[model samples]
Target: VEAPNQTIAIEQSQSDRSKKTFHPVKVDLPGDQITKVTLGRLHFSETTANNMRKKGKPNPDQRYFMLVVGLYAVSQDQFYLLSANVSEKIIVRASNPGQFENDSDVLWQRGHVPETIVYHGRVGINTDAPDEALVVCGNAKVMGRVMHPSDSRAKQNIREVDTNEQLRRITQMRLVEYDYKPEFASVMGIKNTHETGIIAQEVKEFLPQAVREVGDVACNDGEKIENFLMVDKDQIFMENVGAVKQLCKLTNNLEVRIEELEQWNRKLARLKRMSSLKSTVSEESKVSRCSRATSLLPSKKSVPLKSNKVKLCSVKIFRVTIIALIAIMALCALTISTLCLLSVHDRHFEKHPIYRQVVELVTSSSVALSPSTTTAALQGESTISQSTQPVSRIPEVNFCDILPCDKVYCCPIHLQKVKFLNYEKTNAKEKRSRCHCINCNFIMLLSKISEIIKKKTLFLIFLGIDTTISSIQILETQQSIDSRYCSKNLQCRSGNYTYVIPINKYTPMDVEISLEINTTEPLIIFLCKVTFGNYCSPYSSSQNSRKDFLETTQGRQHIWTLPVAKLYDSAYYFRVAVPGFASCSTDPYFAGIFFTDHYFYFYRQCN
Candidate 1:
């Protein structure tokens, strides 16, 4: 049949009652504006005997569907062409020319054409997508479960996201205690309950696919709500799976290492047992051979069996040789095993780089400290009882304990507060008004003076002062004087100090002095001259002049070693001098001299 204007043609097949079908309807429209032709469906059973039904709904049993063949934007030169079937359940049939005969009613026939129903317009749920359906084109959220066909293996063009690196990232994700906002909680009716889960923002850094931003218009109040980040439980579950697998692999590696250690221990035990058994066997064999040789000999002084004696000697030699060999072998095996085990232990520690560094640091410190102390004791210039005893260990002291500053270590010696002197800088030149800039005139009269007198002794002079001294002078005399010990000519003629290396047991009197200098200026250049000697020469005709140590342009703190020659009827002296000293008047600068029990003639102890 031809429609008005000859735009649509419908052809019906004349067939038996058992097999009934209709031909395809061809519609043609010619116009620049009319770019599409939407063919309406016609239900045959609803039609009257002579004409087709119009403006009426079809019966429940009648089958009909309207199909949009093509939609062309003629002005834009664009077309959206689709082919589908219509029934109680909609389906889209694939377009294959000549697959459907002109006489067949493809829509009415069930299971004749493969189809899928596709909506080309916008679809909305709680949210709306202007161009997509089922799930929004932007972001879709399902409050409840979303069921699908159970076909996990249906994925294609897939690349595995499983990796140890991914697992590590997942493990680093922080699980947090959180709750929904009040607005969301009220809508969800979960305000009273506290929730624990990963934060979306935090997880987004590691696994972006697991988190999504979602927003929707409030329906009840028609209020606009802000977008919020939501985490996908499925992605989180996948990450968990990866983490569990990684942990399993790690556990396996640990188990393997443990097994190796256990095996090594078992072997060591076997070796020990074997060695003991061999020793016992050798001893028993020696005893048995001797008894046999004795029984084979005559009880009286008759000629003993020479053969028997020879055999017994051979057996004794063989037994001794075997036992010696076994002992040597056992010792070698033990040494090798011990080295192997130690190597394994070292490797295990090295796997944790930070921990290994800590271990190495502690070990090196212990090694350096103990040897230094022991060497000092051995090199001390005294043969007294105190020298023989172990050097006393003191608790760790911080610089802040003595000064108002951050923690700092002086090192190797206990800093005892002997004396403190404060002063002000009067000029740029030397401060000669006083005998010395910071004179800490304190004598260390050894408590065991009688013992000290019996042998040469070392002493420590701790002096804390505010400014630098131009020169340090030590006066050692036979007799004690109250205030008659200042003279220019009898100054013992000391100069730049160096190690007074003890070449022999009593020649060079070596001493190490450690000093700390702090200046108000950020940088300063100065020469420090430290001298210690005997100014009073009752037994000697000439004064001792030892200028070996020189320190120039030093900032912060420095240590100097001054070695002196042992002289008779002379006492020890110390002095510090600064040529041009410029510093704050109030800030306390520290200077300390320690008489180490050891004469470190070759090395400085403060370093």
Candidate 2:
């Protein structure tokens, strides 16, 4: 309705000039907690706005709405209170308010809730008719920014110039910015804050790419983040295998309990039905005796016998009815117990360690390890050696295809991975949470396939080369002929249809299939590459010479496929280049390492 003094207020302006331009007023907010404050129009509402403010500043990496509604009616004191956060905390006060109305209706009604809010526009109470907010003054701009409560850069200045108003200003800066993310806020930590193109952008605050990069190498600076290269491939794989084994055992136990409950219910139902039928038969027989007693009750001499027979029939009928009812009650009790068991099963799905283990197995499968990297990471080698065992050492008879139940997925990890959550259930919506942690390393493969490849390195490292690690598709490959392959937008003619290049001929395909993917992590794909070469042969286990080499057939080849998507999706790839090496020497290199143009034999471009 009216305009206040035309002077710009000074807030903490940053080095960037755009951030410095706003007229500012602050409420003193102290402490490190999540806060949500709602600003109302000119007059103050003590009840609503004061209640809505929460404590603490949010980390910039996270995604939450810093919702700014359009300006409501400004009070004479030049205040435009805005609603914030889902929780209700609303306040409206002008620095020097022109007393508009002290009536309860004016303040309380406007204070009830926010009026019509236009997206990215001034939020305000709609005038009884088109009012002055329509004038839309060019001098006034509506923008909001959150401040870091404990900004290292701002903290120093505030402490030096510590005054009540200065302290309030600093505290207000912190309070205002508590909800704003670090990326847009002027905090010194330089947190990773990109609004778009962040894979797992919705997944978490940390870019999966950044985390993977940090995980792949060593954190030598004593920082929390380390790269994947620094991680022990074999050790991680073995540890993951152990976690999967534990999960499989847990799953089997839950299944057994379920089966037992089923059996108990079947017996209980049958017993109740049988008892009811017997009761019906006995009651009929009792009624027949009563009919027989009618013929003998004509004289007084027979009165005593007739009375006794009637009494006996009633007693027998009552006893049989009670027994039948007891059986029915027992059956009902069993059914209730079964229902309770199922409820427990559904509720614990997220809390179950087996479920978490299954997530780990899907994320960490068939990874190669690097040796001599982060040797100190495993300080207690004896402890790890005692605890974790390689997949090779833990022999499984699950590959036996003789019977139905005997057919466990040839890979122990796949056999244990959770799928088909078909039980009518309720659980924490953790489908997003199932994404793999960056450091998980576990290998999964069919048993026969596992025997074909010879591991050449005591320590072989599998490096995922993607532009952004978060974009990588790391998922479990199926182990069964009937399993489902859930690829997005793919025309899967059959359930078993998979994308693997057929390598029947030595050099049949020349079209480079470029997987123009953007990721900074390794990819999870089923690859088949064949070559005829004098590849580096493994050194003899019993040979005394360290540099000893053995000659092998230099012109023979074989076809191979890794079961991976049955495991996880971790990288993005668009270009795939295969090595066309016809001849190479045995250097005791890692065998069966799936290197997409990054490692292994390459086709030499002859000059």
Q: For each candidate, what is the lDDT?
A: 0.38, 0.30
Which ten residues in a row are the worst by lDDT in model 2?
Answer: 598-607
Candidate 2 lDDT, tens digit per residue, 360-466?
22233354211111111111122212332222232111212322333212112211222223223434675544323222211112222354344432112222122
Compute the lDDT for candidate 1: 0.38
Per-candidate TM equals 0.28, 0.16
How far off is residue 463 in model 2, in Å? Answer: 57
lDDT of 1 by residue, 1-607 (tens): 2121322223232333232344444445577566554433322322212222255632334322233233233336544444453223221121221222222233233333477444434555444343233443233457998775656698677667666976888778997886655555454444354777788888888788888876653423445566657788887887778788888999998986687567546656776787799899978977787877788678764446666677777878888799889997676566556545544553443333222222222223222222233224323332222322221221111122223443122222442232211112233553343222112111112223344445332211111122232322222211121112221111111221221211111222222223333332122323322222221133322433434445343432333433332221111222232223222121111121211011112222222
lDDT of candidate 2 at residue 243, scale 0 to 100: 53
Model 1 TM-score, all chains together:
0.28
Off by over 4 Å in 1: 1-34, 37-156, 188-193, 216-225, 271-607
